[model samples]
Target: MSDVRQLLTSLQFADSAFPSGFYTMSHGLEGYRQARLVSADGVQQLLADLLLHSVGPGDATALAAAHRAAADGDIELVQEVDQRLFASKLNAEMRTASVRSGHQLIDLGAELIDQGLLAEYGERVRLRSTPGCQPVAAAVVYAANGVATRQAVASDLFAFSASFVGAALRLRLTDHRQAQAILLQTSPVMEQVTEAALERNLTDLGGFAPMADVMSAQHERAEARLFAS
Candidate 1:
């Protein structure tokens, strides 16, 4: 019964309609589209690359670390993880998008979960003591709600993939059917990434996708943009 409840909780948080502000960002797909770098056929590959080399090593790892820290009732360690993740982001746009969504998630987690830790963390975010990256905020919420560490990491990874594929749909790079296929095909990669993130040390947090960073930097200078990052 506890396992079932944890599954449901993970689903609720991972849902696209949860108002995490993920819809406002493209996860950097639009910038690639603008540069003519990706297409319908390449969408899955791009997502896989990101999971393997970027999001897995970076955000997902941070989520795993923060989740464990929160589970241990170590808010200071959680904040340290959050600060490290924020500093790892190379571009201002990526950092801004993360903090913007993070703030929203932390606020929602505080009200919805009604956990004192979340409330305390939210206050810290307000005071700018921590950047409140989305994954870390999610970590606190999931930990407080009894979601296991691995499940928490995997759920957030799926949410990120969904948001990425959703962005691909809006960019007209993929149809609805292809988008679903892309997500289905990426499951194995997600699983592998999740495992890696779970085992990753906080000192190793951050991704090395220089090209993605470059694309994001380019997107920042564009006169017109569809997604925030």
Candidate 2:
């Protein structure tokens, strides 16, 4: 791909533009803020923690697995990825959020592109046969559209990390400059995270961020909320 085309693809999948419903998710940011366990620095650290332990190795890994499955035309493997993602995500709110967003993306993609495998799987998920996570669906679509699996996974990482940053923005936990600085700092290292994840097998994917899971669980029951999980 030309440099310009690559830049546009990157921008299209960017958190600010990608409409995978990430804007609606705070991923426990609400609970953490409510519990006073997060401030500006805490926001940065939480973003860091989420990126390193949760998203980078977890959802991003799931995306890579989905991409590989799609590339091989292995829908069964993709189904396994979906089931594993569904089961490993302990928090009810988090699981619901993932599947709900995935459903939206699938419905939208089916109408907009009709990209064979994508259209089929989107319908599959809609029919309650294949429960996919949004990141996985997005990665599969990206892979089918000629983007490399690694780049697709990398884009997924940035998208996942920025959701927290976006949440921090809305919660007043961090300002725009801090968010930009954090994203910029993580830019170079994103590849390392993506590569390690893409190199893994889907079924064995596992990550433990108990505090994050707990906070997400707590956010589900918060009397008031800014974002959905």
Candidate 3:
């Protein structure tokens, strides 16, 4: 059996009901799908590319940073990564998605988490002094709650993919069974990416996912959009 603290960390971060606003944010996949860039027939590859080219190294680094910052009560790390989030997510839509989800996570944490750091971060972001990107906020949540750096990053990655899968499900890109099949097919890929993410050094955190950036930029001006990002 897992230790009490480990089980608590997993239970807290892994729960989809933690109010990360994950259900609403698509993380650029919605835009790509609507643009027909990610066809229903090719969702597996799309998911793979997203994990590899985007969240695997990019958000994982931020997540790791957040985890450590939370551990040491270093607010500067959170703020630095927030700036990185803006620099890395070139598109307005993607940036908006991150902040929105992060704000929601902090809000939910106030009720669920024993720590008050996330709640304070949410207030700062709402006041426009800080950028409340999801990766950073999620790291705080997991780290404060005793989740390991590796586990916290994994939670972020899983949550990222799960949100896109939810978006695909809502868009009718695939039925439940098909989505599950895609997730299963992608499960191994998630593990591999997590491994790569674990091996990654802290300094190598930036990424440029061009297609995702373009899609998000277009989505910002997309006249009839369903999801936020």
Candidate 4:
């Protein structure tokens, strides 16, 4: 029964309608589209590359570490993980988007989930003690709700993928059916990426995607923009 409840909690948080502010983010897909570097057919591969290279190594790893810290009641360690993740984000837009979404998640989690750790973490974020990146905030919420570390990491990854595909749909790079197919094709990559994230340590907290970083940096200065990194 407890396991079932945990699964439900994960689902609730992972839902695209849960208002984690992901709808406003293209996760850099719009930047790639604007640069003409990505096509409709290339959407799945681009998403897979991001999961394997960037999100998996960076954000996912931090989530796993933070989850462990939060589960162990080591708020300081969780803060350390959060700070490290924030510092690793290369561009200002990316950093701002993360912290923005994270703030929303932490605040909502505090009100809807557990008021204990979520409230404390929210206070820390308010105090500027931590940057409150989305993954770390998610780790705290999932841990507080008794969700396992692996499930939490995977759930967030899926949410990211969904957001990415949804962005592609809005950008006209792909239609609804194709977007679902892309997500289906990306499942194996998600599993592999999730495992790799679980095995990573705090020191391996950053991703190395030079092209994506370049695109994001360009997007930051574009005269016309539709998404916030």
Best by lDDT: 1
User: What is the lDDT of every predicted structure here?
Assistant: 0.93, 0.78, 0.77, 0.93
Candidate 2's clash total is 1
Q: Which window of 10 residues has the lowest lDDT sum in candidate 1? A: 108-117
lDDT tens per residue, model 1, 1-229 = 2999999999999998989999999999999999999988999999999999999999999999999999888889999999999999999999999999999988877777677778888889999999999999989989999999999999999999999999999999999999999999999999999999999889999999999999999999998999999
Tens digit per residue, CA lDDT, model 2, 1-229: 6656655675687646667788988888888888898878766667767767777777888888888888888877887787788778888998889988887777666665657788768777878887778777876677666677777888777887788788889988879898998787777667677887878777568678998887888888888887988
Stretches of candidate 3 above 4 Å error? Answer: 1-5, 116-127
Using lDDT as the measure, name the better of candidate 2 and candidate 4.
4
| Candidate 1 deviation (Cα RMSD) | 0.8
114-167: candidate 3 lDDT, tens digit per residue:
776776666777887778888887888776677887777776777777777878
- Candidate closer to the true structure by lDDT (higher is better), 3 or 4: 4
TM-score comparison, 2 vs 4, better candidate: 4
For all predicted structures, in order, the TM-scores are 0.98, 0.93, 0.89, 0.98
Q: Is candidate 3 or candidate 4 better by TM-score?
A: 4
After superposition, the stretches of candidate 2 with alpha carbons farther than 4 Å from their true spots are 1-7
